[model samples]
Target chain A: MPNQEKIRVNQLTKVFLKHKERVMALEDINLSIKDGEFICILGPSGCGKTTLLRILAGLEKSSSGEHQINNSGTDRPLQSMVFQEQGVIPWMTVEENVSLGLRMRHAPKKLINERTKTYLRKVGLTPYAKLYPKELSGGMKQRVSIARAFANDPEILLMDEPFAALDEQNKFILQEELLSIWEETKKTVIFITHSIDEAILLSDRIFLMSSQPGTIKEEVKIDLPRPRQMTQVRSDPNTAEIFLKIWKHLQTEVQESRTKNER
Target chain B: MEELKKAVEVEKEDLRRRQRSKKFKQILTISSPLFMLVIWEFLSQTAIIDPRFFPPPTTILQTLFSMSASGELFEHVRISLIRILFGFLLGVIPAITLGLIMGMYSSVRHFFSPLIMALMPIPTLAMLPIILIIFGIGEFSKMVTIAASVFFPVVINTVAGVMNIDKVYSDVAKNYGANPKDFFMKIALPGAMPVMMEGIQMGQAIALLTIVAAEMIGANSGIGYVIWMNYKAFLIAEMFVGLILISFFGYLFSLLLRGLQSKLIPWK
Candidate 1:
């Protein structure tokens, strides 16, 4: 059998009309993902990284070109999104928020309950399941968000800067938690981030994007071993070389965007 | 260990002081109205202010008691409350549903925005004449006028509430496999609740105001009508009794609203 892709985007472009001004958010963005492959799209702020993810998530439409996801698993949800802010939904209790995706899809009572309980425990939010998002701290809220996404059992998980707002300790803890969860299910994950280290730590491959009319500039494969730790990235001689390469590519793009903005 | 104990003692002392201060504030709040009533009583007894207009608190209390005994106060309050209940529900239910729909769909908003904007500025009392002309001096007119008054504040506030909900929430709903019904129920309704509560409270306040004005102008059997009749007859104490009853009910309803708000939007 031919190696058919799980998700394929062909010349996908998005133009946002703001204040009657044409703003090209993404220009000819094309990418493909295999099933269960963790991919990260790295870019600076306002680089349409979020726009690209939104299109893939079906929350926004591309202006030109087609984006398609071939879901062989008919019952599983096509995609589930983890947003950077208020993702767990403040109005819902942790358990309710965690079960949102499943509930939305009309999943049965027993499966919803079992999955919610399991995921909440996996995210260390079992004690907080009955609490509202407002009552929980930032880290705990994100844990609920993460748990909700995983519990849905979607074919693909699209996370947009899920840890960008957290403090270092919370970010690292959640990142480790995310890795643990992802390792088990290994659902195709597309994570968008500005942090180079986050991309290196989480993704099997990094798609480096440039700012002006956001497009993929480079794709660097990360052959880092599974069961990875943050400390391991520091010691691995290969990681430094990869980090420098990504940094150089991103640094130049950022500088170029800054210069254009000044003009 | 000694330092830790000292720290604990300090914290306890601080908490006690805070509790004491909070108690003092509550006492002050309760006593301020009574203090004013006492002063008013003293002044009225001395005939400092005309007893004809500013009757003594004791006389007003007697008026209240006599009205209660005669069952006139109960009849008036009951009729007015019935009007308010009907009018409030008539305005609020549709207003909220349409407001949420408007918030979700801009085309619906566009169609209604001009109509609401044009209608909102005209006072409910101003429409009373037209309402009277159409429905005549009946229960329907008073209720309709009150409903008009109750409608705008709730609809506008609810729309604002729904519109101001974080965009990310709806996006999250769409990204997941949430159907349209799920979006409406799970996302929009609960998300708009805190602001919608504001609209409902304002609706209640206006409903009270409109019902009073409406009863005084058009109806024959309500608290407002009784107050107006007492004014015509120069029964100053009875009018004061009516005013005091309105104040009491207003305070009670506000407390009820606070309880509902806390129950529904505990996260807020």
Candidate 2:
């Protein structure tokens, strides 16, 4: 059941009209994701990692090819996305923002209340639940986003650099919080990040992508033990090895991209 | 422990500074206008200025007090208030509805944007002649003109408010599988509300200003009528009473609106 195929992408392509010129953002992205697998799409800037995630979230249509998220549960949503910024609605209170996904789906009151309570507590936001998102710190707002994503109970959670804006301390804490929740819920999550260490810490597999015609360059399976803590992951010998691998791959691509732009 | 004590002392000093500043501000706020009123009373009592045109503060206050006691001011204020309230509701309801729709749909925006652009420039008072021709110089004409004034500001702000909602919110809502109804009510209305409230406030001010002109030009029963009648009869003090009353109500209504705005969207 753990290895059951939850997502499949076959030769998926995305082309964008930037200033009226057709630029290929993602070309023939193909991947098979197992149920409950944690995926990190690692890449340099403009590597089409976010575009792929947005496509999966159904926010944008793929130009060609196809992808599918198998929703086995009758009523559960297929997916929910945590945006990199402005994820929490400013006008809504923390409780309201967290309950947005469930309430939008018109879930029963008891279920909404129960899940909202559970997630709020899990994210350590029980005390701030009644406050508006505007009153919260940047770290706290991201907590609301994470809680809302988990509380939705979607088959898949798509996070596009959810902790990228956080400082080291807050990011480390939220990353741990996310990992613990993922371990308990066993939900499929595809997190996009540029930080090699972060990808190593959270991912079951890292999909390295190349720039320009963004395509999947390599897939690295992480054999790190479950329940990862930041300190232990940083100290792990294997982590350093994998970091070097991703860094080496990313270096050439990023350099080529910067040089090409310089021309 | 030394650092903690230093921090607490710093905090106490900051609080004291803030308290002193707030007290100074309070005193200045109450005294600034009172100071002006006393100077005006002094100048007018000594006949430094002609009392016929520029009446003393006491004379205006006496006129206001006399009119209120005789129930004449009450009648004029009541009629004017009713006209403004009706006109505001008539303008706000339609403008808000159209604005929300126009904001969400580009086709609607495209169609109406030009029309609004062309029409918004024409002064609401300038339309009074046409309004009088159409509605025939009664309470209806005054209401229609006031409504016209109220419409533009509310609609423009409402549209801008809705259109300015962050794109990320729409993406998040779509990902969550929100239906159209939920999108409009939860996202569109509330997202646009803070800006929309600004429009509503502006609309209230324009409505008050327009209602006076409207009553002076057409209706015979409002505060504007009293002002015009007093001016014609050379009752300058009575005219000052009407002007003062309008200003007082404008201040009162804006305060009420500010309270409503805070209650409605405290998050903003």
Candidate 3:
């Protein structure tokens, strides 16, 4: 049986009014996410993945559609987003950034401190809690962003390629860290990214999108067991098979984008 | 282990170099004023410049000490400070309040922008005659002149600062369900602070600049009054004393404001 529905997006359409010309960013986009499901939206650049995520997070209004994140009858906000670059407010210290959402909700002082400390430790940023974002390197800053998103304790996390700016080594480390955190918390996530390996590694289901007037092309389920590690992925035949299936679908879309650019 | 020791030696040398440069800068800062004073004294005493007109640094110091002892300098400084303090408050508080309103609402900005533009370019001193005629060459006109001088820059800078804040901050706050009060107190205020602080500092500077001109026009007592009255009487030494006092206080105001910035926004 399917898990409880955590998020539902129906007939979501977005159009950009570019100098009196309407550009279709997303057309009849529809998605359903289950409770605690780790879903990745994998697509090429300019494929409206970010727009989809923004709409889901309520950052932007859909031109036409119904998008709902089930609130679980809580008084708190239902979702939080981790943006790709420098989402941590530069003016706030690491601890303040992590404690922000809780503070805004007026969560008790004790709970705020406890949750902030817990996530800071999880992301290995406890020592740097007193430092500002300017003092942090890019990798460390992204870790703070992750810590902050998790610390908010939202019903769903919307991450828009949060680690896309990091180096390869940092990416692997953060991906591993994020997966471990997800395994522990089981928070439903809608992650947007262009990296195929990242989608395969972290996500339970990958929704692939085609470019230039973007729409979901296919949904590829990884069917991987929980508590998976990044190290043993190369030996898993399932990883290769899923990668190939998604690549086969994506290859043509990428080629089409390139040819259009050339023309 | 040998390589580690070599690294430690290199670090020690770097520290020593830094210390040497820091000491040199400190000496230069301390000696610069003294060097100028000494040059002025030599020029005056050796007849390179007429002592009657230029006066030696020593005579200026003597005149300042006597004036200070007789309570003349203190009275003037007190009167000047009171005028400036009141004038600064009159100008700054209203400017910030209106500027914030204008920045938050486009309609308010549209209404005020043209008026502010028209008045801002007209120099504060140029309005002195009209103001004196209206307010009768009393302390009121002087205060009004200083207030007008301070008002424009603060409003302009404050509006710019508020409008210039990145939309991302509001987006993040909105995503977290921040109410308007929390949004303003936590995000908008702090985000706009660096620029607002710049505006305040500029306001303080303009207050200082306009106070002197206002006092020079018609004032019974002030540092500016001392300078003006002494120049008229050809008490060159006392005029130099007044000029020095003005410089010292101007420098102090800036230093105090800078310290306030660091205290208020230590994140930077």
Candidate 4:
């Protein structure tokens, strides 16, 4: 039997030394993520959602905290991160970029090829396997990056607003695809985004954060059904109600952050 | 509209014909020097430009053939090539390594930048006399001079190559759990290859030029030595042959480097 708890974070804090001043980026961040859950960290820019995600991904060190991943001894849960800028290597072809994590892990060439091809097909990028990042559109590049993260078959997937650069239509389609892929893989996902609609649409739970020395202000459970359609979700009264509640909390933080930034 | 369509068709046909003609012209252009040789032979036979001083192309070819048969031309070419190879390797390897280090670490680059700036302005050829005096006009002196000629451009271009890489690539590598070796091999090396290859190309050309000049000053057996000896003996034909050989070797060397570059970095 799998452990119910996937990731546990206890009193995590991050402090940044900017010049001579010690600035806290995140303070007293504590959260427990259940297995196979989709969680979104929502906050304004500089609210330390990204900092929290980075710490979780082991890319950045926390000032003080404890984090543990429950793998049940089957394997160390693989973690993969997707960035906003679409971290596809410009020199590599789409397929090559998709297989990079596997290659890094020293996976056999045949397995890498098979997994890369499968993921490319899933992302609707099979035809673009030979195409370099420079040849792809913004949406296509993001798809490639997502496919790469998926190809790793990670236990936890961290995304820092991966689709924030895409147009609405592309974003909707990608969101649907992401949900479908997540349903099949059941990976624990920690997505950070500034979009309220995105958080409401995708997350099983939204961890709304407050600005400056960021701390989780509230956690909103999403009781919507599976295989959610964006159109239906938008039209559904419950979705709109949840979005409005999140927005009301976010608006004040946004205004305060803007004023602070200006100063 | 009909006329315009017809004109378009005609223009396309003309373009196709022009492309074919241009290809043929390029082939002819490459062989033009050889054709000039034929013309020169005929002109010399018909008594033009004093056959003694400006030898006919045939005479030069014959001299080249005789020299090769006697192993004289081969010896000179071998010596010159060995000198260039040694000098280039000595200069370029250290330059690239130092350049990469300096580029990756800004503090190191800052410390060395002023030193490089001061040293770069001194021409490689100007140090020839000092080098000869120190090293005693031997093969070492010639090799060291050639190495010096190749070093600066390689170092400068290598630093530029490393510095110009996109920061996003490095960030991506870091985010993906890449260690230092993986980051350098996968991102930094490939990213900077194009500029580094160009630097190597420049270094190669400089190496060849410096080697020849160094040979002229002190070497006992090289193309430059041949040229100098021929000139002193008033053997203008032999001197011209040496000049042609130098050009041919330089051209071949460049083509070789370009081919290697294309093969190594097909994407660039």
Candidate 5:
């Protein structure tokens, strides 16, 4: 049997109007993601990748076209988003933040605790469960946000550059943690990022976007095998080749956007 | 066991050092007011300044002690406190309710914003004559004036607090399938708490500022009444006593509110 279609975006477009000027942010975007497939929308700044993700998450409305998220049975929520900014509720303790989605769903207290503990442990944040977000580091705050996203156990995870703000060391650690969690759950993820290496490392398919009326330029499939190690993947010759391809497309867009700004 | 015992000893020493520093800071704070009192007393005793107009701290204390001993000061304090308490509650409950509502609904905000803006700039004391005319110089007029003073700051700040919450919080709430009730209770209220507490603090301050004016305008009893009566009679020492009482009340309320703020928003 064919793989189940998890999400479908058809002719998706967005136009932002400032005064009388009509600026097309995204144009004629089309995508089909399979169940449990990790997809990344990779682009330079002003490429409208975040806008596409926002539309997918129902946080924004597309000026034209439509998209659908397939129900992954009755037990799970449709989607949960891990924002680019620190998404953890500052007012809540780490444990409370982790369990917030479950609480919203009116899940039993026992299940909430269990899921919250599991995700907190997965993110290496069990000891800091009682601490508020203000007490945490930038990296630690992102870990809580990651734990909160996973603890909810949504059918699909929509992450918009969740690790984009972290330092190099912190980024690698979280990427590893995220992979471990995704390995266990295998939930469909639509992650948006500007980094080619990050996209290649985490995604099954990287959708490269072009700027100045942004749209998908190419879809590069990362055919690396399961249980991938970051260090091992870095050493693989195939990884460099894929990186060069994505980078070639991305560099042009970045240059184009820069020169356009100089005007 | 030996290591554990050594650690306990070290911890105790650290705690003792902290306590000593804290006590030193407290003494430093107290000395400021004490120095002010000493200077005033010196000036008055030497007749460098007119004691008739600016009585020394000692004279004010003496008058205060005598008035309290006769039960008159306590009666005025009791009545003044009661009026403030009632007026504060009257302004607070409705302001909070309406603020939350306005924060959630743009239409409601649009309707109320203009009216609130127009009324907010006019000082609560400026309305004293109209209030006195309407309520006829009774306790009601004084309380209403206090309530009016508090209402604007509390409402404006509460509205701001609610609106100022980051959009990501609400988006997260919605993505997680939060219903309207959950959105308000779990998200909006707690998110807005820091600023709401700030608003309440400001409201209490304005209420205190208005209360003296309200009482001075029309009332037979209360600290304001005492100050007005003393000023009219040229009893400068008694007026200073009233000033000290009002200051004490303001300081006590601020301390109480500060304690509450810390307890509620430990995250901040």
Candidate 6:
């Protein structure tokens, strides 16, 4: 028998109207993610990857179909989203930003303080805990965002291009740190990014999405070993082979999307 | 490589020049006011302007000292401060609350915008005669005039502050399951605070201006009353003293507000 399902989606669709034009952002999307799986959703811009992630995090209402968490109940699941822009509040200190979710839940002060310190240490931000967001660098701010989600101890972590703004060095370091955190916690992660290399390197399974009225066109499994490094992955011929395979599917969808828009 | 080395040296020298210029600018910024004061003193002592009409800085300082020794200056300042505090509370608290409500909801704002626009430009001081007739020339009229004067900017800026907050912050807060109170305290208030503080500072300055103007019309006690009394008596130095006190108090109030703003919104 298959392992217990962590999240299930049934014919999920999202429709939005922009400038008086009806746009279907996602259509007939059905997906099921297993427990402790790291799934990356890869798509072109405006392809509804973020929209799908938002729906999973219960941040957006879908136009149709059902989403169930852990096959447990209809209630919303415990999840946190790390936004593309590293949505750390500028007015708050690193510790306060990390502790915000706990504060919202009215967790005990002792518990919040302990978890905040733990996550700050994990993200290597303990030295700068008292500093405000404006004082931090872009990479450090994103680290704070990641620490905040981890501090929440959610059953699922949704990341929308969390490292999109950082330089290559910082991105690689954060990717490694994220992997370690996932290994320790085994929290199901739904990461959204447009970079195929990042998806192939970080995810256990990659869901390639087509543009406009986005649907999953392919789900490619990377049987790469755990504790993977970027350098090793790049050197592996299989990585480039899989990347081209995904790109081939993506290119046709991208062309069709452009052609349809031109009309 | 030689060109790059020369360019780096030139850049370093340019940075040093800029640093020196900034230091010189700061020194001039502090001393220019004192330099003007000395010039005014020299001109007045040399009889360029009639001392009777335009008292010298020394004479004004002497008058200030005398007023201080007698405790009369303190009495006027205390009374004026009390009036301002009372009026500012009355004006600012309600304006901020209502402005925030209007800012959060478009329908509410639309309903009130016409009335606000109609009333805002009527000049609160223009109502002094009517206010005096109703509330009489007592503290009540003075306080009401000050409150009315300060109300508009406080409401307008607060509304702008709320409207200008990034929707992303609010959306994140909602996604995290923040309730109304949490939303306001954590997301709304801090996000709007810099602008709100600016409004409070503006309201405070306007309140002080209104109090002095209102006192000039018919009042027994504030700095304005003293100025009017001394002007009628032809005590030019004393009138200068009152003018100086007003400027000093306004400057000090602004300095205090600046300190408060930095303390409250350090990130900004």
Per-model DockQ: 0.82, 0.87, 0.63, 0.34, 0.61, 0.53
Q: Best-fitting candidate, measured by lDDT? A: 2
Candidate 1, superposed: residue stretches over 4 Å from native: A1-4, A18-21
Question: For model 6, what is the error of residue B267's alpha carbon versus the real structure, in angstroms, after optimal superposition?
Answer: 1.7
Pairwise lDDT winner, candidates 1 and 3: 1
My TM-score estimates for the predictions, one after another, are 0.96, 0.96, 0.93, 0.81, 0.92, 0.92
Model 5, A1-263: lDDT tens digits are 12799999999999999999999999999999999999999998888999998898888999999999998568888888998866888888999999989999999999999999999999899999999889999899998888888999887899999989999999988888889899888889999998888888899999999996899999999999877778978999999999998888888888988898799
Error of 1 at B3 (Å): 3.4
Candidate 6 Cα RMSD (Å):
3.1
Model 1 agreement with the true structure over B1-268: per-residue lDDT tens digits: 9999999999999999999999999999999999999999999999999999999999999889988998878989999998988988889988999999998899999999999999999999998999899988878878888888989988998889889998888888887778878888888888899999998998888888888888888778998998899999999999998899888888888899989999999887
Q: Model 2 lDDT vs. the true structure?
A: 0.92
**Candidate 3: clashing pairs of residues:** none
Candidates in order have lDDT scores of 0.90, 0.92, 0.88, 0.86, 0.89, 0.87
The regions of model 6 sitting more than 4 angstroms off are A71-77, B1-20, B129-137
Clash pairs, model 2 backbone: none
Residue clash pairs of candidate 6: none
Predict model 5's lDDT versus the native: 0.89
Give per-residue CA lDDT, model 4, range A81-158, as digits (tens).
888865778878888889878777777899899999999999999998997788889999999989988888777899
Off by over 4 Å in 3: B1-11, B129-141
lDDT of 1 at B70: 86
For model 5 chain B, where is the 10-residue window of minimal lDDT?
A: B135-144
- In model 6, how large is the Cα lDDT of residue B12? 100
Candidate 2 chain B — worst ten consecutive residues by lDDT sum? B211-220
- What would the DockQ be for model 5? 0.61
Per-residue alpha-carbon lDDT of candidate 2 for residues A121-191, written as tens digits (9 for 90 to 100): 99999999889988898899999999999999999999999999999999999999999999999999999
Better of 2 and 3 by DockQ: 2
Q: Reference contacts recovered by each candidate, as fractions? A: 0.85, 0.95, 0.53, 0.30, 0.72, 0.47
lDDT of 6 at B62: 86
Give the fraction of true interface contacts kept by model 1: 0.85
